[model samples]
Target chain A: MELFLLSNGKLSGEAELLGYAKRQLLAMIERRNITSAVFVPYAMIRGDYDQRAGELSQTLGIKVTSIHHAESPAEAIAQAECILVSGGNTWMLNQMLHENGLIVPIQRAVREREVPYVGWSAGCNVATPSIRTTNDMPVRNSVVLPALGLFPVQINPHYIDAHISGHMGETRDERLAEFCAVNPSESVVALREGSLLHVCGNDLRYFSAREQGFKVFRHGAETREYQDTSALRSLVPFTCH
Target chain B: MELFLLSNGKLSGEAELLGYAKRQLLAMIERRNITSAVFVPYAMIRGDYDQRAGELSQTLGIKVTSIHHAESPAEAIAQAECILVSGGNTWMLNQMLHENGLIVPIQRAVREREVPYVGWSAGCNVATPSIRTTNDMPVRNSVVLPALGLFPVQINPHYIDAHISGHMGETRDERLAEFCAVNPSESVVALREGSLLHVCGNDLRYFSAREQGFKVFRHGAETREYQDTSALRSLVPFTCH
Candidate 1:
């Protein structure tokens, strides 16, 4: 099974994280010997398809297709060489995945050595069990999405949740704290902008500008944040096997 | 205790409920012979407050002050002849109520005859204890602003989530099924757009456009939608008390 996951810092015409994102994607391809990849941009609503999909295709120079237009994911899977996912509303993207029952297929594609999957923002989030810990809203409540479980740990892209102290909100720290209270065994990887996480055959690691705490609940123990994912290795005993 | 809960019917605006709300407030006032009321507009974040508040105040034709600007709810309670709340975002409004610790005081004001309180939308929602079974997302989160336990039951407002059956979502019926699965005693009132539930001093009777079912759950019992809240009364046992 070959899989490649690429996460951009941020996207939107305003945020210029694509250069670094391209570097990250190219790095993954070079590492995995991947030739061409299919781009899945489900994070966006069905309305802005042409513009967003068109740009991503032009930007990454890959074949971008809308799974929403296809009769089924099996059809979309048929044409794809490799999978590259763009970032947007995590809940919306998660909802789309759930509404379509594509979780297992995507996992199967990776498992069957069909394609290496690359996911950014929202795509990066649902790689774990649930979408409840993200900074997005349930604008349309399809939040009960099935997880690909590519990573046993919950990846909180835009992990810092910058608006924490200013918005009178449950800060990234507090939200993770609450999540830990509910899901004790769940590990959270708090990726700041520019952080790159690489997963090759169950060996997960993070390469970034800064190393900060990746908090996890220690089974029946309390939640605490540490400097990196490796620290929580003891907590997640069987991540590989 | 003088408490007024503002609700919207299938098509009515919360502001329009002001008239019905005013009548309830008037009766509460006359029963206690009150002369002043404090107006709370904490939920008007996304609306035109100046206009809506004016119409609401004029409809009641009663003097109301915005507790939104108040430093403390005690100040709002002590100053108001009656408390009139407007609607907007529940998460935001609930955050304010929780941050300011107003739930207890508001409940106290109603119980001790200190003031008559009027609540709408988000305001009415937080009147119950657990909003975990809500149809809305915590677009924002707050540790302090838990819902008041005025009612043990959770409400799913604007119930009848998207009518698209094939859509990936837990319908109002499904959410109650989940709710009942754990807390058999938990009763969920699905308030359609036009329903105004008259929850007065331990008595919760429906006053709405249609007679919808109140899904009830009990341990070791079959979960079913009843003809009305009365059918769920056996579940509420306390309403009789």
Candidate 2:
């Protein structure tokens, strides 16, 4: 399986979507000779789906077609050479994936056919076991269904340590700690902005555009930061490269 | 029904829990002649429940007993003079409320017997029609059940407009706007820290210990700030005082 789970779609000053990982994306595209991809934009509420697809197409040099345009979304996923998931609202994205019955098809495409899956933010969230570690609000009244689970461990995208002054709410760290406390046996990989986790076959790699390290959170243990994927081997099957 | 839906329990540099609303709470207790109250501490994941109850007792000059110590939680709610909810994790608190069968009993006590209901943070989120506007992460695997719905409209506690530098995640305004986009017919009252909404029978009042205004968010409408409860009357059946 090949996957590119990005922390977010854009950085602070970059105008192009996914511009921070352009070289890596171009390398994968060239190696696979991929030309077209199916885009999942269900996480978006106020944003235009096709406009985002166009931006992604321009970013990765591929023909990105939003699944909403297809009469059969599952079929679109089944026949696509690549899968692209955008970031917006995790709850809505997960709900739409379940509502449109595209979860299994995407899973089969990524796992069995070795289709390349690229996702950022909320897209990165659904790649995990569940949407339990998301930072978005639960806007919909629908039931919380399990996610695609393409990746084995829970991940928190857009992770940060800063807090707005005088904002008396749970910080990102506090929320992740609460998640760890509730699920003591589980671990959460917190990916800061401009960072990503890439997996190819049995090899796993970590990258950060800002040269920052990722943190691992667990219950009854100190949250430690690492510059590489050495700590993730025990949680996932991929060998650190 | 008598209700005190607080934005948070404590403020910056304040050591006493619920100290911001001490005067109003004392007045309510004196008017109702309340001596003891039942505390719901399910929202607390790492904090000590008994210690929090003790602090609340000291703040209000009334006995605060945690409902977890009761032999029957529903029975305790039925016999209690008042209900106090703490601030912590909303998902766990709502799930525990459903699991312990306290939803209907608390509803009946508040609606029928007019039990004074006091809740802060997560407690305030559950008082609305749903927990969709809450700012906490959904860390549990339980189904999304309807909240207590003590308040007719949704209330977002710990609401802020500031953003941390370099964080790419959605801001509080954007998240609430997304909620409005999804639920067009509903409105969310964004309460800042050290603020609260008090309801007594047919009268409704808004108070911010820091003298701040609250904002109302709706789909395709300007999010306007109000220093009084005049704008909330159309959404709920209460006279602004």
Candidate 3:
């Protein structure tokens, strides 16, 4: 299985979507000799699906077809060389994936067929066990907390330590702490912006476009940030050394 | 029917929990000759319930009891003179409210018995028709989106226009816009920190310690900020004028 789960789609100055992960994406595309990829834009509430696919095509130099146009989205996933998901509303995206019957097909493509899967933000959120760690608002009534369990651990994508001064709401750290308190046994991977977790077979690696580190949060253990993948050694089915 | 739906609990310079709305709260308490108020601390994950009730007691000059100690929580709500809900997590609060059968009791108290309902942050989110407009993370697995319809329209509490530099995630405005887009006919009131919406019998009013205006969002209509209550005229039941 090959997965590129990014913390976010774009960086500060980068204009293109997935600009931070460009080199890795291009290299992966070239190595696999992939001709086309299917784009999952269901999570995008305020975005144009075709425009997003067009941007990805221009960036990756590969044919990117939005799955929404397909009469059979599951068939699109079954025959795709790679899968790309947009970063938008997680709740809507997960619900649409379930409603459209694409969850199992995408999972089969990535797990059994070994088609590469790339998702950022909300897309990266569904790659995990559940969407419990997402930061997006629950803008819809029909909410589905569970997502594709392609990645074993729960991930908090677009994690940040910065807080707006005088904002009385709970900070990001506090929210994650609350999550840890509720789900004591589960651990969360705090993926900061510009970071991506690449999973290839049993070999899982972490990369950052800004040379920044990622943080691991657990119930009782102290949350520590790491500059390399060595800190993720405890994760299941991965040798981080 | 009396309600004080606060955007948040505390402000920057304010030491007490409900310091900003102190005078108004005291005036209402004295006017009604209320003896005691029940504090609903279910939303508070990290904070102590008893301590919160104690703080409210000192601040409001009324006996405050945390409802967690009651043998039957619904009974506590039934016999309460007022309900004060704390601000921590909206998801957990809404779920617990539904699970413990406090929704109808609180609704009866506020709607029939004329019990004053005071809620901040998560509490404020639950006052609306649903919890979809809340800004908190959905940490709990058994999620409940619906809430007591004490307020007819949806509300986004702790609403701020400030954006962290370099953050690529959706802004507060964008999130509310998505909500409006998805639920086209519905409206959202974005309440900034230190602001509140007070519903007293048929007369509804708005207040802000920071003297800031609240923004109203609709599907295709332009989002406009207003210091007066005239903008909320179209909302159901409530006479915003």
Task: Encode model 2's per-residue lDDT on B137-216: one tens digit a residue.
Answer: 89898755489999999999999998888999999999999999999999999999999999999999999999999999
Off by over 4 Å in 3: none
- Write one digit per residue (lDDT tens) for candidate 3, span B107-191: 9999999999999999999999999998888899989888999999999999999999988889999999999999998999999
What is the Cα-based lDDT of residue A219 in candidate 1? 34
Of 1 and 3, the candidate ahead on TM-score is 3
Residue-wise lDDT of candidate 1 within B28-133, one digit each (tens)?
A: 5667666555766655443465566566566665555566656776767755667766655555566677777777787777666545556665666777675454
Q: lDDT of each structure? A: 0.55, 0.94, 0.93
Instruction: State residue B231's C-alpha deviation in candidate 1, in Å.
Output: 38
- Per-residue lDDT for A208 in model 2? 99
lDDT of 3 by residue, A9-120 (tens): 9898889888889999999999999999999999999888999999999999999999999989999999999999999999999999999998899999999999999999
Q: Give the top-scoring candidate (lDDT).
A: 2
Worst 10 residues of 2 chain A by lDDT: A141-150
Rank the candidate models, highest DockQ first. Answer: 3, 2, 1
Question: What are the per-residue Cα lDDT tens digits for candidate 1 across A1-241?
Answer: 4433334434323234345557666665666565555556676542376566666566565656656567777657655667766666565676677677777777778767547776766777777666655554343422354467776566666654343111221235655554554455455666655555666665655555444444443335565665544764664433332
